[model samples]
Target: MRDEQDDGRGAALAELRGRLAASVAVARLNRTQLAARAGLGRTTVSEALSPNGPVPSAETVAALAGVLKLPPGELLALHRTASAPHVVGDEGTVTADGPGRAIEGYSPHDLEVHPAGPGRIASGCGGVGGAQELPGYVSRGHDRVLAGAVSDAAAGRSGIVVLVGTSSTGKTRACWEAVQPLADRGWRLWHPFDPTRAQAALEDLHRVTPRTVVWLNEAQHYLGDRAFGERIASAVHQLLVSPERGPVLVLGTLWPEYAHRYTVLPAPGSDDLHSRVRELLSGRTLPVPDAFDSQALAAAAALAENGDLLLADALTRARDDGRVTQDLAGAPELLNRYHNPRTPAAKALLEAAMDARRLGVGPHLPPAFLTDAAIDYLGQTDYDQLTDDWAETAYAELAEPVHGKQAPLRRTTPRPSRRSPAPAIAPQAESRLRLADYLEQHGRTARRHLCPPASFWHAAHTHLTHPDDLNNLAQAAESRHRLQWAHHLRHRAADLGNTAALYRQAEHRDAAGDQEGAEALLREAADLGNISALYRLAVMRERAGDRDGAAVLARRA
Candidate 1:
């Protein structure tokens, strides 16, 4: 029997490793290259291939599948060969005649992974680990939030209570700890994204033995960007507020930075959709300990259950160096180390990301924008391969797809709001269209993969004949979250006597606290028939107590 089991496990590993080896070969990737694409370290991939290397976790396998363009199901199948059933708390024994078969552990209606990229696919998100208690699974303030969430679910009083914090703060483990106590009380996790599963769960509530818990961790994908994402939100809402509720608890977690983006609407105030989303996310939002030390590191190792062994080692090193501070103050430094940029391409990518963050755009640094920065700093290279593999060194928690080809993401860019009655979308679309046309006609650059206008930076340097083209390019830069790039283009346009560009540059300068520079631009813009610039100049003149000049300029209105 033991030989049979070993033989089965060996065959599974061999097959899975075979597939992985084939993918790397087909892509012509070395250890470093393969690691970068799979979002793992070169060492992790190396170990998986080595004879003595430990079995890779499901998350590792899944990430490789995503980067290799292999089927996720195959990795999941491979995971089953190595994965032992996660034991929740203590194994429970069934009554002699209750089910006719002996069962161990309080089975919480048997929770399954969600289809929408469970585990690391959704950026460190997961359903219950079935209390497998993967290493590094720490419970901070566990009793406070988990107990409350479970109680609410049992009583049907709470609609949704999220464990909101920055990434890797042990939010998921806190939740599992809370739910484990109630496993025998009829609390099963139900994923409502599938239409069929959703309907069945909603209809068959009476037949449910324990209550149901809809674990909605790192669910920004469903709420923020795609239309289908909203469906998941709606289904969760139905379960939450369902008139026929029977102890069905809705719990979730989110990065606080994304709260407004997902909860609020672009249209302002409160609309039905916004209200619904807001309500779905309402309830007790418990804060995790958010501390990292000896305990946290151990918890992380345990939580990973597998693939995270390499990461655990890295964290241990960081901890030993005294670099891993108590909280996120040392995050950037730790991130830099974790990125471990050995190659020029990898170093450049890390620098670009760190630069953006230093410049205050790193929090919202989209993958495409990072690619833009990389090309600007490193010249042209194969970023598609780099980002797929090793970008995780810098972007440890990329909640969204790195390719940015998933769907129209909800951008948090500041735009001209609805006061103008003309939607911001139309003007933005026109600007992009105009820029695309200019790039194709003059530069002869055809855009593909919706890649950035790589030549736009060069165009910004050159003297363009048309003012509209310059201003349009500026807007495109701003839309891409490259504020400095936008300012540079606007300054260039202003030099060419674009009045609107002059005003825009003036605003930029003023916001940047270069008041004298702003005043100079405003003076130029006023001469070019910009009324707002004149008004700004008048205000400045008044502050300097040139009352007569202020009156004259103000009368010009």
Candidate 2:
């Protein structure tokens, strides 16, 4: 009987191995390439593929399956089958008997709730002191819409509710509050984030059952992948339309830029990059305003009267413009820290992060980049006064969370591989940091007209990887009439396959009377599927009296 059991397990292992090998072949990745991409050692990859090897660990299988574009859930199931001992009367069927079994991804009850703010401390009579625990949820206009949608989901109508707003505008808080009742009703909340946003969604979205809340906080991460965003959007649309998947509420939050990108229609003859995303988002978005209006503020004041000191303080401290959400998010506290940093080095570090963010750099700022850029904010006297470990001390101070909530600069863990579940291979000695959302937004206004110094431009050129950011900096440089910097940065962005940068570079070349250079760039952009570039080339051809070439280009466009 033991021997028969061993044979069954071996067969399962062999089946898993065969599936993995086939998937690798289809993906056209050898063991070495697969290992490198998956952030796993080559030896691990080889052993997992060996026919006679033991069942791979769950993480190993997930990493490989993610790299191969196979469903990690299905692959992990196979791994479990091979590893788990077969019990009599135990079948492979999963039943919705409890929270553990019912949830496909993460259980709503298991999620760590974000702090609302400091509650009223126990004081004499109506005295409000320091914050104690989380404050009461102050009702807002969007909350009403969110509640109605949640109610609809409870009543067997699955729908998506996307809250669109800027940073620190309480979009996430609203979504978190909306899904609370679902947890009590045995509804599962699946927030896919293990391997990668797009990969995790593609792998597990199909299996999302009814009465589940698909939490897509920062929805751009899931729907911004050029390769898979449309596919994920299609899957989401399918999830909504399928009658068998009733009572599933797909909730998402998005910044305005991301919302615009997904919803805005392209011009005629241009590629429709976000058609599926538009379809998925059509008529389902609820705009969460950045500031509370008078009516909302009045309601919050009512809540403040009920001993919610956080609300009371926010009401007292809120500017005339009504930045109550930012106050609640410790935005003022973050700014205070920035203004009154313990040391000049710390202040310089904060300034560097703020400048980088305002200049359109991505959220994750490397320590090295910050260190390199911060020097430009300091004078030679200040720089000479710095200790050997000044950078370390400064980062530690700024990265500390204020009010037990937001920080001036928050440390970020190394992200998992884009193609696999495993954490990407990165140096362990230093961590990346991101400026607080509130600071990033504030700096955009405060530093809008300020061009970064030479050191900033140099450090960004050395450390920045995203083409969009490079293009943005290039545009900034061009606006400041720093032509040399603009030319180099724009060229780098174009080289990185940014078609928009290619179009912009062509325009710059044309403006400089370098018609040949412009035409060459336009041709490259047109080949890379930029319809604007094709149209521009058509115009150029017509101007050059190549009527036949012009006609062909126009027709192609």
Candidate 3:
């Protein structure tokens, strides 16, 4: 029975291969051409059609069927012998339909039809997932807050919406949902949600698309550094009111002072915040007592570790001098000096920090709650050391609980206190110190060592392990001095399974005289979904013999 089944399967496979070969021939395209379109190499096409061809992968079959303009089901069915019964195992089975399969694209109708489940909730920063519903926006008290903010912005005829709340308060979820309509309306919207990733992307956006709606979530952290903040603010202003690219509707969620300083929108009402919080917790049962207090306690704990009284005095002096809290980015140093000297100001800052840690200030409090002086003073010293101390204190506090109890350590991660940085130094001096600073902070060497005189080619070769570097190398290879180095780097990197480098390596090989090697490299890259590699492989396959195989691969490429 097994032999019969195997033979039937083999015969079916042979029949399908013959039919596919005939179809390619009838199409009047060579194997290489087909391979080029299909994104496969000549050899790959040849192997697939060979008498001892391996069982096709689902992805490969889909690629081939897509290129051949044939139903994957039809081709798959043709591979089953008439004498053998088709059996689907217990594993999840894929059913392929006829040709001309309808492709799914971005559509509002489709989005609406798709079930909107309780969305994956997350906050912009330190907070983890919140209760299913948000506390304010759609909730009674929170609804008022959302409505007030939205209404104020709407009344002012602002094109943007700003939702502000503390961490884990569902600000991210609210903003994400609120912006869906913008996307549906075909408006390009961007967010600076992830600092490390978004900064690079935003730089690209500034270079390319000038006027784009930017929804900045947690705008404070990114703009916390005065220079950095000012640069970003300047960019925002240009996007908003520039003649060349003006009026990019900007909505941002931030602390009150930061919002007022950076945004054109009005503040959201208190009713909205309360209603939203209530609504988010409506369906669910949680210990709602002291919810706000708990957050305050967390904040206070953070404050006590680093902030002191001297910082508060410096902050007051700066404020009295008519400096905006946004500009008070540098007042911490004065506070730090006074506090360390056992001055009355230092005593006051410590008292405030202790109060902040114990009593917890509500979100409704002014930015003065986390004063510029306190933030700066805290930032000047090692918060990490303070954190280490805090962690130790917490561990000791919790140690007594498990002493006589059978329970293991709860494995809780303490909340990190958010502290601002020290005052900025001169730009030129800062730039000169950056390398040493980075090495000291991160314990790593800077990439500047890769290239002397900073040639694109040199930098590319040194960072060949990076795909972007390989791309840079490829582009630089067009220049006389960089060609050999680029090719060499790409060739080495390709061997390490870097797809971009592999594609570049194939190009270099083709430019050199190794057609076969180039074709092979392209095939490998194509299999990994490198479109350029697939395109190259198809061309190479056609040049080599096997017109039928080339035609199939070309379609796929």
Candidate 4:
């Protein structure tokens, strides 16, 4: 029996060798002669080709096949000769039963590998790691805010909570850690605009398990831009309020200005600066630990001392006018007007401190100057601006005496009655738009996979620009990897009062060989006073044997 098996295997091997040799012999020779022309060496090729010998490595076989101008499968076939009259190639298959004798079969998908390109692909904003656990890094207070925000979102206070800070200040790191525990417990993560890999995870939010935690890095990109913000806000409202879908908990991180622009909170209130700072600390125990070494404590205290003043003044400016928060980021430069050196010393003090070392040593330094190096070392330029600017603005506003008795309170505004209209909610439009924007730039696939435009604005272009959304959809559908789903989204978008969506539906219709249907959708969109939709309807009608209809639509558009 053993001899019979060995003989069978040898026959197979010899056949494979013969086929490989034949193929190689017919091929042109290169630096290395074709394997068929030279024949395989006894020591190496013979053993590899032998029935009892090990099968050649994939790389080696492929190399040999290349040299011989032969298909590797042909060679492999000879090495495994079958007794049956019908010889099955090595790429064989078998099916298995599920729970019983009945079975289902599946084909193996061969993956093609491609080299990575220059630009970055979005990944779920994993994290940059934390500082408390690492040396040479300060523990930013954002961790507390993130932890608490996640708790709040899970508890059902709906809406996005944005974390704002400077670069390398741990906002992304803190958010990642805070959301991980929640994710393990079944919270899904959604990201819209991922300037980096961190934000890419949002693409899967719709398909992920319910009860999600969305972390949008650079969330502003989605919110503050053009057409993108509108769609995103609508999408967010639809998903979060959907009866079928579970709640989507969101945590967005961005620079302070963006956070100010997109946060649900009102712009920093007069006292809200302190509140903001405390909130940033995430209710973490403050009066910071004595456990911290003295130098570290001093540094923190100095920063706090200065920060409080800046916040108070900034918030006050905001109350008087809406522009203060926008200007706060640039307040240090704004104080250039107040840099007089010889003035009364909240007057001269700041400049003296700034110029003290630069001005050279003097036996008699002015007493008016607040020359504390500690303040300078701790970054008190803005803090000084706060104190001086606040004092100037407060005195200017209040110094103008009231008609009667006591001066009107400096920073207090009486509350309105409950019957008054409440403050308008910050729109979710920007956030939604940003996500769409991200998708348009980055999706690709192996073996012909289709993806929607990552950028919401880009996707909305057809309808938005031409009012022929339906035609756009039809055209898109005709293309490889048809974007039918996007067409659906565009149609629905119009019904939801989004003019851009209506226009897109018109474009989709035109693309589907239904110019009349396209014209009708565009008419409705235009009737809604969507100028772009109206214009597109007219153009599409003119192209489709309806010159008079095009003329009327053109006038309307």
Which predicted model would earn the best TM-score?
2
- Model 1 C-alpha lDDT per residue in residues 78-194, reported as the tens digit of each score: 756643221122222111111111112323223321111111222223333432223333444544657766776656563567777655554554565576655656445544343
Model 2 spans with C-alpha error above 4 angstroms: 1-133, 332-557
Top model by lDDT, which number?
A: 2
Model 3 weakest lDDT span, ten residues long = 430-439
Residue range 44-107, candidate 4, lDDT tens digits? 3444444555434333455577666677776655533432112122211111100111101100
Stretch of 10 with least lDDT, candidate 2? 91-100
TM-score of each: 0.33, 0.49, 0.24, 0.24
Compared with the true structure, the alpha-carbon lDDT of candidate 2 equals: 0.76
Model 4 — which ten-residue stretch has the worst lDDT?
A: 106-115
- Model 4 stretches astray by more than 4 angstroms: 1-145, 154-159, 183-188, 192-205, 259-557
* Ranked candidates, highest TM-score first: 2, 1, 4, 3
lDDT, candidate 4, equals 0.40
Of models 1 and 4, which has the larger lDDT? Answer: 1
Per-residue lDDT tens digits for candidate 2, residues 109-216, read: 233223344333234321123323555676788999999999998887889999998777887778877877776676767777655777667655755666778888
Better of 1 and 2 by TM-score: 2
For lDDT, candidate 2 versus 3, the one ahead is 2
